[model samples]
Target: MGKLKGEYIILQNEQFYLKGYKDFANERLKIEDYRGNIEHIFSTIRKLQKEDYVHKTIVKCRTKSVPSFLGQGYMLEGCIPGYFLGGDAYFLCKYHDQKRFTSSMWVEEDKQLEEVWKKDGDIENKGVITPSIRKATTLDAKKLATFYASVFPIYPVPIDNPDYVKDQMEENTIFYCIETDGQIIAAASAEINMAYRNAEITDCATLSSHRKGGYMYDIIQSLENELVSKGIFCSYSIARALSFGMNAVLHKSGYSYQGRLKNNCYIYDKIEDMNVWSKDLSALSAGKSALSAGN
Candidate 1:
């Protein structure tokens, strides 16, 4: 087995990620012969259990391997369409502790919140000055970390570390922040997949004092516009299932509800399900192609 900074445990063929900060384990099976390696995969899961790193196990595999994972007591959580170059990806999970599996309260909360937002009408920015929305530079890493730490106890990425946040920003990840009086009050990111022409909008956070002002919605809209201008065709987010405000943001922003991934991530000291929301931006391009063909 190989190890990467003790964060990921890489086997000969598969890899198990020990999300130490989150206290959960996730696996990625890279081999094509998933059917043949069922026993090996289970054994690796058992190893994860013995190491006391098993609050839950999330398995991300291609659509074709769903059956193999299902045979091993893994339940189908959800599917992310066009996640893999026009092919869909499926998420399966096996919860070691039954207590970790609970009904998703966000589903109902989302419906109620949607109705409320509809009745209340658009969020007013009157009298309240809007923050400047712009791309974050590496110099803003420390501020970003501070904002994230204040919002979430545990996150998938090392948001507590300014260096890690800076590195990701230097890489393909683009961070957008809402700045007021030289302070970042809210932030979000787009993980661009240039090969697939899609992007994952994630890491949305806002200071407690700055909540309910539609800053996140503005950030999402700005990010989506930037992505579309860059030739990206799809944008999606895996928002916390229990967050009424976040779900409402996606719903009001024209993103369609796709599905839910159960026990997908650890946040606020517990394993939480995630709701998938996506928007397709390829309609204009498809229409142009059809017109060109007719001409």
Candidate 2:
């Protein structure tokens, strides 16, 4: 994706991605003229569709474009408050593969899991001993892929490939893992956005045998601390909305609810909505002007 008339930036990732094609709101565009701009966007989408470059188009825009997008058969998926400095960001999607974009077992599983989390309080470690948490290295790539494949049938990236995992690690994506008996049982990562002073806490996975442990919370806290120390101001996650354990971990860890992305990703063999949660790391600042400014 490239510039379409110098007003907006189209982003397209040919590589494996869930939300691969999108249009971003740039500074040059007049927000009030979004209706006209959307026509250009639709034209671009049609051109891309004809070439078979994208199966679906996901548009992320400021609130100004919501009305125009809605008028053009796009549906609002979610909104994230303070996603762009002090403003909000909206997610909209128009699918060309509607039949393939339906829900699956993970949807119902999430609902049931959430109910259990609400009633049981924190996720228990059950009888398994707490695993040791540490940063992952390239050597852990194969194990990481295996763990991910065991949990998710479809993920954003090909986590079943060790080479891909290694590339991501080399690109500054930090992976943290919980290990026991010299084996990795759970893992997660912080996708850093240095230019925006934020990070998306994503790619969380654990082996089935390691369920119901507080390892996620521990890993999240550890990642947050690392982010804050490195001058990252915000940490956010798009968690499966139906999963009680993931949502509970974010909630208990002091993250505030933002909104929900409907049919946002293909995971666990189906399309599912994801819950948006964010934590303000700048609030923990100790008189650092840069950190304070981020708040």
Candidate 3:
């Protein structure tokens, strides 16, 4: 995402990614590292809300610390399976603004959520051999930027910039794509958190004409296989709640709906709510898969 002028603090063993004020749609506090007491973290959040007016706060912590945040009025928003070494991770959120917390368009979003929830995680037949999805290298950054620019007028990140895409690849992000006649038609990526053995599947896009061809399913399946090979299988996606196509593809690929983030992101054209979906590929994890087993 585009860097905004926001407070990024690192205190001894603790770190915070406070959502930037310029990105008003996603203004919140994100606790990246919390090795100390819970009260100290909450105190910081309170101070941030009072002085900065952040609309929300999100923290990812182990199950052992869930009660401490919940007692302070934080609600469980979602879970990241296999996020810790041997334990699952949780995302707890507390809202400072009632409007940002409430979903006025829930009724509309509910219909889409229900429809996607019931879908079997199976790739629909498209009557043609699908192009193999490939792992994108830095050489493809410029083309990827051009492709993203064609699909979105605005994004939470400066994805249209080649340097930004290259920088991400150099970091922890991996991009995958489907090509037709030497042209990229659809793409997605996994933002890896190696420290936590987890990744977030995001940045999905497709050419308008190739919508129903199931290219997305291929990309997701490949991404899962890749992560599993890296010994990372805690997969989750933050999809736009109101978008049926994206949500359906994620559900059909074995992700379960955890919860929603109201006014969470500024995507495409406007600020939108996001739905959290996750899948666990570990032996102990339970979920349906549209692709082959042993992910």
Point to the candidate with the largest lDDT.
3
Residue-wise lDDT of candidate 2 within 1-295, one digit each (tens)?
1112122333334321112223121111112112234455556555654533234556656687678778888777666565565456676766666543464644575566456446535556676667778999999999988878778877655777888889889977899999888878888999886645677899987777777788888888788878878887678898987777788778877787676655565567656667778888777555465666888
- The TM-score ranking, best first, is 3, 1, 2
Query: Which stretches in model 3 have alpha-carbon errors above 4 Å?
Result: 1-7, 13-25, 51-53, 283-295
lDDT of each prediction vs. the true structure? 0.70, 0.67, 0.79
TM-score of each: 0.76, 0.73, 0.86
Candidate 2 lDDT (Cα, 0 to 1): 0.67
Q: Backbone collision count in every prediction?
A: 0, 2, 1
lDDT of 1 at 112: 61
lDDT of 1: 0.70
**Residue 172 displacement in candidate 3 (angstroms):** 2.1
